[model samples]
Target: MSDRSQLDESGSSAGEAPAVPEWLRRARWVWLGAMLLGLLASVVQLADRETLVAEIRERSPELSQQEVDAATNSGILFTLLVSALTLMVVLLLTNRMLQGVNWARLVLTAWAGFEVFAMFITAIGLAVLGRGTIEQLAGQSVSAVELLAQVLVTALEIAAIVLMFRPEVNEYFRRMRPRLRRR
Candidate 1:
């Protein structure tokens, strides 16, 4: 029998699986682009610490300058750290997905879903609390460009999720599945 037809320990032919689709390859790039946009948004927010501090002071005039500074600085640092970590995760997961790891696709989809839900909850909370508008909540940005970046990133994430679920991509994942060994 030819090597392609020979069954391995998994009882499956070596060449049984289909190749990854072009759309899925494009989706991986979109995912990376979204992560880059998110990182940019975080940087912009970090640079707007003065505005954040001023807003805090306006909300509570009783707060000392030292307290406002500490709060703003720490908050910006935390956001920056989180954004950096998220970028790392996106890179790792994208690489895995490109390699046709089924779990990676599922995990990335779940992560994107959670992010969308969180953004919605945050927007509702901001509106209810009489804080800034939805645009402001979206990116913590005063500039239009920053706001657009935030919106674009969210859209890209949604698109990536859809692309991952396409029939061709699903077939690729199935083919990439590892063989299970009996005990």
Candidate 2:
């Protein structure tokens, strides 16, 4: 196809999105919900610090729990961090999708993969890295990395959904799919 054919008179591809879709709108809402939840978790974690310490002292009598600040870190730090990251990436992807940038879709894919990796790390920590033999090391601050992953994954999901409406991306996929033949 000719270069001119790639785009319309407005210079954006004919297949590019002009506005965010209902699904994306819903995704945005979901992202907003996650953000609120993260914020709530942070607040609760902050408040729970004293309670956790008191419980530890009364129960274990040998364990020490550290203080937490919502603005910085807390028990829900990883969740909150991930929520913030997801929100930022979704917002950016939503903006880019509306602006009709095809490359944004590719970025979304990469971000999603990164997010899955982060989630894996988080799962590892939540399991083997929790209150085990090396509890102190596991408790060390490390939410930022997970947050980055959340944002990437959210972006990837939103991008994938948005790409569904994108004709160019679909055509590319269709071409890439293997042809099926009846025997």
lDDT of each: 0.77, 0.50
lDDT of 2 at 81: 71
Residue-level lDDT tens digits of model 1 in 89-133: 988998889878877888899988887886677556656854456
lDDT per residue for candidate 2 within 1-183, as digits (tens), equals 865358753355655423334554454454445445445545555455555454445545544333323322443566567757766876787565434444554565566566567667766766685634334555333344445545554554555555444555444333323321111
Index of the highest-lDDT prediction: 1
Can you tell me which runs of candidate 1 are displaced by over 4 Å?
A: 4-18, 59-62, 118-147, 179-183
Indicate the residue-level lDDT of 121 in model 1. 76
The C-alpha RMSD in Å for every predicted model, in order, reads 4.8, 10.7
Backbone collision tally, model 2: 1
**CA lDDT of 95 in candidate 2?**
60
Best by TM-score: 1
Clashing pairs in 1: none
